[model samples]
Target: MGAVINQFVINISLIFLFMSLTFYVMRTVLPIQRTSPLFVRFWFGVSNGLTAILLTINAIELGEARIDLRLIPIALSATYAGPFGAIVTLGLIFIGRMTIHGMSAPFVDAILMFIVFFLFSLVVSRVLINRVKGYAVYIGFGALLVLIQVTGSVGTGVFFNVFVPYFLMLSLGAWLCYWAAKKLETHLWMFLLHTHRATIDELTGLPNRYRTLEQMNDLEMSGKPWTLLVIDVDHFKQLNDTYGHLAGDAALRHIGQTLERNCPPSGFVGRYGGEEFLLVIEGSEDAKEVAEELVQTVRHTMFECQGEVIPMTISIGAAVAGHESSMVVFERADEALYVAKRSGRDQVRFA
Candidate 1:
């Protein structure tokens, strides 16, 4: 009885340790959904397969029975990775069993048992069920299979002494795995959400000013043609003074959306600051045509708020990024913007 409890605790501990390692990898190393599928398979399939083999090697003996917790890892693999994972784990487990017991009736029995479990797991993988149902169906089935394997095979004394306690521990171990997986999933989601919020502008729904600067620095070494357009809202202060700040916000959002829709596929637009936007395009054709197109689009777009119409226009300064640093290009564009504003807003100028 004591041996049974000790082995059950050890098996459950090994599984918990593996789950902790997986959680660490997902949180610090891999980007879950963004990670490559092949690498994902290695982590979810091959690693778990090895763990299953390890569990088999640690099988404990009680009277006429030898037992291990290999099925728990197999079920977990199927839950995360589907059919491919199930097959990998079961194959490794069969090899482990063969090495331990040699050619015998138990080896044949293991083969038959694996085939049935593999087919059942395949069905579980294809079903459109939630995580809870998937875990319940697969893990519950594994537990029942383990119970039946020990039923008549063990002596009456071993049955009462070893099997009952191990079964209870197995139930707890399965619940622990489910709980930990759910927690890691929630942490990954929150991490992604926090990252998105940090880099995105809430008001304009575009990349923020800081992200634009980062892109500019990267583009300097990209060896591709680059154009930077500095844009400022014309008479924005006057509009805010006449109507209200709320209308000014609405006007900015309208202009941002219009700029995004009209932007070329290769161009990226972002909020430069209050009443200002920057467009980075991949071309050396002076950026005049694109700038003019944007100017005309915003001019024609009418922004309405609370049944009130607000007139809006923008002045743009375009600069071709030559063999110059990002700072120099920005300075040239800012100077050109001054030129456009000084010569009367709502026009485009080149640096």
Candidate 2:
């Protein structure tokens, strides 16, 4: 009866440890959602489960001796999620250790390990690591880990050979994981940059018509209402004729920058076509405030070249989204812009 009770308690402990380790591994491997595809998510889940199984086997081999497997998870979380994720991973590990072994020397050791990983990884993510400047981070992390373990050994009076070898092994593993993560992160960043550039206008740095339409579709799908404002620069041809095409280009660039800076937080600006810009505004009932702001900003802008302050004013037209089709919205704004131009230049008119 005594032997059966001991076996039952040991089995229960092992199960709990295995489950905690499994959680750690899964969180590390799971996709961050922004960058991960469905297949990649599935594969990460599977790989983490397998790793948990291996860790469990190793624990059994060691006669259920307490080992700090926390660092493996922390290292992974640091590499992917950066400092915050590393801290969360560390907390999970600390909680896991306390549950598995209670408060003792080993638990203290585990807490120290978490702290070291959290601080070092925060440094790596913030200052030392990038695609080109990343090798230094790996070296720094490895050195930091070595210093921590050496200090820990000194304090604990543990067998030097055993602790030193294990520390070195873990450091090597951390280096490998960080290197892999850095490579992945670099590729992901590049992918996002390329995607953004493809969907954005080169001159205005705003989303192109395609991207704007895509966003509208997405918002519509998600049951959100939106409004569109189409703006046209009045007498753009006059500027080209008066100051030459170069000055006209300069004017466009200036206006693009200004509009980008001044648009509301829920607004998106786009370069729709030649001398024409589009804006998507959400939850804005009166486009008058926006229209007035643009009109004033454009009227006051002093374009300087060769110490000459060249002045220009723009006529703007605005339209809301739900009342019409995209084409109709643009046509209405264009009509309104014509009204502004006809009424007298340098004004905003809405339809």
Candidate 3:
């Protein structure tokens, strides 16, 4: 049994090396989807080595596998790097165990563990992170533990011996690790929520004053060339007086949706205040093109309140912020908006 254990450990080590090499090569050569090449390169270099490190630590624990903490890397990989990250990590772990242990109990154990972490990456990360809460993650962890036990029982002794004591130990350890991660994720999410709410308008779901400030600050710090468009709904006060506050609100919501849909991918559109909205267009000089597109989108969008169509038009003032402070840039656009309003309401003006 002692000799068998030693042989298994050696096999596990060799398998880890092979897994790491495979990940590295794939990362280097394959075209990873949606992620930056730099990020792909970084993940490739780190994931396998990290997995090996975790495996090495657990292997040293021998039969006493307190393996729940092993999920930290897998969870991070899946959460930050996405499904590809999870797949790479999962594949390496699976192949590593298969290579070293010759398709025995450890192989089955590895598969069960991989499945649990993979689900964590796939399901837990998507829901938990988006909800901006940690409670979901903790619940997810507890559920995963139960699932692991069931999977363990099913796969037991077909390839590996099923031991009640080991199962109990593994489950308990996993619970502890999961609980810690949940707490950490919850606090992190709370912080993100607070920040998002501060900067985003509730009704229109557009960035408010705070968010615009932040965007400007980011642009200033990065020294990136960009364009700002100040959009003011024409005759908004008159429209409000004629139609009612509720109708006006509905119209505003319609405008927000239209702007969001039509805006460039990198652009940020938000309710600046009242009937005023702002768009920060990145990496584009053709303000005329963007403003024209926005005008068309607004013209085409229909706003219905109480089964009646509320016709609306926007006066757009665009200014390029090239090596200028955000305040200065906004001032330029504001002056342009004033010009647009004075000349005619439903036209684009640039400064």
lDDT of each: 0.80, 0.60, 0.65
Which candidate, 1 or 3, would have the higher TM-score against the true structure? 1
Q: What is the per-residue lDDT of model 1 for residues 121-178, given as tens digits with 9 covering 90 to 100?
A: 8777667887677777887887777678878887788877667655666677778777
lDDT tens digits by residue: candidate 2, 171-239 = 554455445554554556566678878899887677887887676565555555666666777678887
Q: Which structure among the candidates has the greatest TM-score? A: 1
Total residue pair clashes for candidate 1: 0
Ranking by TM-score: 1, 2, 3
Residue range 231-347, candidate 3, lDDT tens digits: 999888887898888888888888888998888887888888999999988765666898988887787778777878878899998898877788998999999999999997788
Each prediction's TM-score against the native?
0.68, 0.61, 0.59
- The predictions' CA RMSDs to the true structure, in order, are 5.9, 9.9, 10.5
Query: Candidate 3, residue 323: CA error in Å?
Result: 3.0
Find the 10 residues in a row with the least total lDDT in model 3: 60-69
How does residue 25 of candidate 3 score in lDDT? Answer: 49
**Which residue runs of candidate 2 sit more than 4 Å off their true CA positions?**
1-69, 74-92, 109-176, 218-226, 241-246
Q: What clash pairs does model 1 have?
A: none
